[model samples]
Target: MNLFSEIRSLVLDALAAMQAEGTLPEGLSFDNVAVEPPRDAAHGDMATNAAMVLAKPAKMKPRDIAEALAAKLAGDDRITGAEVAGPGFLNLRLSATVWQGVLAAVLDQGTAFGKSDMGQNRKVNVEYVSANPTGPLHVGHTRGAVFGDALASLLDYAGYDVTREYYINDGGAQVDVLARSVYLRYLEAHGQEVAFVDGTYPGDYLVPVGQALKDKVGDAYLNQPEDVWLADVREYATEAMMDLIRADLAQLGIKMDKFFSEKSLYGTGLIEAALKSLDDKGLIYEGVLEPPKGKKPEDWEPREQTLFKSTEHGDDVDRPVKKSDGGWTYFAPDIAYHYDKVSRGFDELIDVFGADHGGYVKRMKAAVSALSGGTVPLDIKLTQLVKLWKDGEPFKMSKRAGTFITLRDVVDQVGPDVTRFVMLTRKNDASLDFDFDKVLEQSRENPVFYVQYAHARVMSVLRRAAEAGIAADEATLKSADLSKVNHEAELVVAKKLAEWPRLVETAARTNEPHRVAFYLYELAGDFHALWNRGNELTELRFIQDGDAATSQAKMALAQSVAVVISAGLGILGVNPAQEMR
Candidate 1:
């Protein structure tokens, strides 16, 4: 049970009683009323602004409304004290039994303690790491991949029907470049020296693709020009690059539900259909765009082009759909892709992009809004850049990737668990500095280590309790007499556990998975604090001398902490460590 929600219901009931008795107005709205933990624990256990929100509408003084509401709240069995604080704020102190109930709920529910139904099984499409199939994924794509994967998992945990998707960028000029590069490698595999000039890929990772090409079509395209083999080579090279990309994502345990090809939008009338929908809505026209604001390009000139009225939706300017030469602009395909997503009957869509794509956010959101006719909402999350440091210096690029560190390189040095957890230590919009030495160090400063250490400590307690022949399993712990867990130090942990359900709903509502990582760290801190107190107070120890009943009560609390930690880590795609080693 969510204690906060339960208490909020109590407050609402009291307000309803006030209205029925004519002490308050009949039609006042209570939608804005909130019950949450007090900012300062010394103030009370919980605080509410119900009186403050209702006073103006009731034509009454704030303090008068607060005092009346406080009296009604104090009559509840769970509320030990309710005091009217500064400016109609109500601070409530709950009995120890209230916090004790939190522990019981956690034990009874196990890892399902904080699961929420906020999503209501709404279908959400999360598209991320749509990196071009030109090479192995780099550090930037790695961040997007981890963020999107964890977010999908979090949505699923909160009861959303989530579809993980990737958009393959193979229909653009880049794939042609990849084909020519692979063709050069094919020549090199035939014992011919080929120089990779300005526009060709020079990475050694493509050597295998070239060798495979030669083995399949030996001497067929040798000494031939670009026309006869360009089409076949382009298709072959894209599939090979996608194979490499799949392997890279597999290393990090990311599996996509769908890989939508950009090529499919071409020759399939999808792009035309998307633009025609806009035209039917009076959103498409032929026009000349104003010159860009700052630092206009050297070849900048305005020409009449087919444009979409993106500004009518939300974008800063109307965006071009087709260039003057009758070729579709880059924005056209993007609009078509989002149109296709909306047509799939999704309730919501989210795109995880790199920070460099910040300028595209507004136009993309506008496209989705216009295409969906305001029915489907779209959220675009941009993951900032990650700087890698090692031995107190910036890490150099990988030789295999030629220009950047490959995702495999990072995952190889540190395991996938470390990489995933550390990547989420910061929000998606903030830049992160990843220090190899610091992350691997077993210290409290490292969040991954600190959280795992807390879980291990609880595991250690469970093992010792099992050795002592106490029934410490979940079934026994759920029914344990928790009256012995009335100490102030012990109650602090119970209070933190009580916040899990509220946190799950908040994080899911905001589309922020990093909040889960942050909450886990705070919960671990509280658990460790209780464990440290046992060092000084012998009675506070989890295991008491010849007190099996009391020892089981404390073990129940310890097990609850583990259950919540495992649940939180599971949402983040992290494995809770049973032991630090």
Candidate 2:
């Protein structure tokens, strides 16, 4: 059902014909030839760069090749016309039957119309929202969670076996701080006054963990030392914070396939094993790094440290694996984590990190490259900040979190559907300004409303058709006489439907789920435009006066739009609204 692919196949066939007739060279490669929508719709339905790409290799003028290719394409049954434009590009207009057939395919496949096999069931590990287990997820982690979840769903729709994982940052100083914070709360529960100073988590979310600890141990830790309480309380508080985190993600309808603990890498020889793998490749060494860029030599301390030759694998500088203090650096555990992922036999790995972690991208990729011997590819996607606005003013922070807004704050203001959809309206790397006033509006400016309105409008049409005694079931509509759907406005929606399969493959290939959001917005626009057009043109309406066949045919096209909309929203983890509130 990929119309672009079919047209590209036709272009390739025409090139083969040219070669057979000796009009082109015998061994010209057609790999670069592409058939895509024309930049301006006025040019034609589709355009190809076949002649321009083959001109230099085939020793022929681009115009001559384009004219010949146009002649061959014009002979196809689906191609109504083909003309050379702008020296070498060939513009093609498909027959009306082709557009009608696209709608038929949509009805036949339902929501699965645009699903792609581009991934070929490749195993992809998507690690995201590896937040510290100190508190509930904040707004920053919310964006990463939504983005990563949507990406995993999008890849799954494109036929990839994706594992959605969250790496718990529990093996760091932060967990120790959380343990101490919970200890203070526990002391407070025992009727003792306590103070939370710097380097300790003081958020109210940890209060429950403290009370739970008091409930469990009672006065056992009341007079105990740090060594006696630290280890037990660290484990206890981490599990509690993780429970809070899991509940927060559940509020957004996000559930990870696995929760990997950073503590599992410590004292397990895993970090040493990962480093040994790199050392065996001659990538690990003890060396003093050069003075950092823009820093004077005196401003920096030159220390010989155990480092990874990350520069050899694409990093800007070699990264240290162990500090000069003889303890492991922060990157050591991350390398071990990725090495674990590669050892799990995943073909590809994607890490969804916050924008603050941008500096770690190259080093992480280099480590994965060194560990996997360049067999597995690592792609890191960074999610930028989200600034919330209410009534044109910056939204206030959460007192519960003590610093930033929590994920529950956003989800509570707007439901999970609106939150998820709006979060994906912008690319992951772009900063988004989420305005509560604007996003909740019913106007076209809100993409969530616009897309949902289109789906709701289609549902209304189906309901009316059902009430009018017209059998609008799937079987009846899919068999409707689509020949009556020859209007330009009707064909526009069908043409957009044809782009779904192509769009899915493109979005999956680039690992950008925002493209799906953008595409769904455009498709909804086309459907809405056609719906508005029916107001002035009586015959274009989904329900005719007495022509049941025509009404059924038009309803078929409308239902196909809803189907695709549902499919796209499903990938975004958004439930399509059947009717507007």
Candidate 3:
């Protein structure tokens, strides 16, 4: 039951009636008409911009259209009052029974109250956490992981067919370095001392991998040169590192639907096929690129390379597909990967990258556009850095990871629920500070704690009702006489509940999951305010003394708050707390 949408429908019907009666001109489009919450709650329950948008098209004054529309709306039972404000805007006041009906609908639907079908079941692939498969995931990957996972869940709730994917960066020089690093560890396992040079990994996490390799092939490649052992060791070390990364993701309750290997695109003719598709459209050419913008002329040298006409789509300059040495550039493989996705029959593609990859956004979008012939759209979201703090000071690096803090380092300090919730408190492109001490504090300043406490408080009310011999189950609450729940304070919470369905569609359309966290916080604040007011006024309490009928009416509102919070937390992949510890 979306009250805003329902009211907008009513306003549209009124405009149609006015057109038929010649009160307003015909052939005016109502697509821009919108009904939303008023900025000042004291003004009215809802506001509409129908008059302002239709005035110029109908060749009529805005105030004249607003007055006619207000009279038509006043005839309906749902709208008790409609007044013209600021010459064109219409402020509407709904009856108390309408807000009460919203609470009853919450009880009827439970956690499924705000689900939407706006996506129309379109196939969408969300690829994230595509870090190099050379080591365990670090703090930067953690932010991208949480944001992407939450977004996938949000799209699913909005009725999209979503596939969560991870692209393994195994076909790069870093994996070669990992192979040599494991070889050093294997030599150490055989009682030989080896020093880690500047190119090899020095983290202690590889000790076990080295031991495992020695157990598999005993003294076979012990003294062999690079050619004899490099290929085998590269395959073995990449598998080991991927296993570590999988475990790190499991720590946060994340399980991807697919893990695409970059090495699979090599020597498989996929790169040639993707480039051929572009070449057939006359987008591929050989040209000499200009020197970089900030480079000195003496330090620059021009060379002929294979280039793609990326500027034709939207990129600032044409991008290189192959280097001068006849080898494919890094962007070549990425193009092939997206072509593979398009061939798999996906309607849309979304890439979640780190903030440092901002330079690749325009080129990547251009490639997908040219490959799909502008039929499919690609959206790229970049997650900013996460700065960790301990005891009001900067946190130190992890010993296991050698230089940066690993994902497990953050998850272990505070459990996965807190880590996931705090990561989404800010926008994906905004920096976040995760303070170990402040997040764990049981205070209102902590958003996770505040939101959790609201759910826990509702549970406490249910328990108290049970002890007092009052029936407060969902079935009983759904059948309660909600007409008695007409207090202004109680109605305020119901009004907020009416916004959930609308909020879900807005957040999903914008691809912003942080808006869900923000809405949950605001709903919690409204609920907490009513709870505090009940202390001074006994009639506002959930359990009225000696009156089970009125008590059930008030308890229904509190229970509805918990239902929405649980749904919101489910979208964020955080478990709703039943009780505070």
TM-score per model over all chains: 0.98, 0.99, 0.99
- What is the C-alpha lDDT profile of model 3 across 1-581, one tens digit per residue? 77788999999999999999999888999999999999999889999999999999998899999999999999999899999999799999999989999998899999999998889999999999999988999999999999999999999999999999999988889999999999999999888999999689999999999999999998888999989999999999999999999999999888999999999999999999999999999999999998889999999999999999999999999999999999999999999999999999899999999999999999999999999999889999999999999987899999998889999999999999999999999999999999999999998899999999999999999999999999999899999999999999999999999999999989999899999999999999999999999999998999998999999999999999999999999999999999999
Model 2 misses residue 1 by how many Å? Answer: 1.3
Residue 110, candidate 1: Cα error in Å is 1.6
Question: Across residues 391-417, which tens digit of lDDT does each residue of candidate 2 receive?
Answer: 889999998988889999999999999
Measured by TM-score, how close is model 1 to the native structure? 0.98
Candidate number achieving the greatest lDDT relative to the actual structure: 3
Query: Distance (Å) between predicted and true CA of 336, model 3?
Result: 0.5
Local accuracy by lDDT, each model:
0.93, 0.93, 0.94
Q: Against the true structure, candidate 1 has what lDDT? A: 0.93
Clashing residue pair totals per candidate (backbone < 3 A)? 0, 0, 0
* Least well predicted 10-residue stretch by lDDT in candidate 1: 293-302
Query: How far out, in Å, is residue 3 in model 2?
Result: 1.0
Model 2 gets an lDDT of 0.93
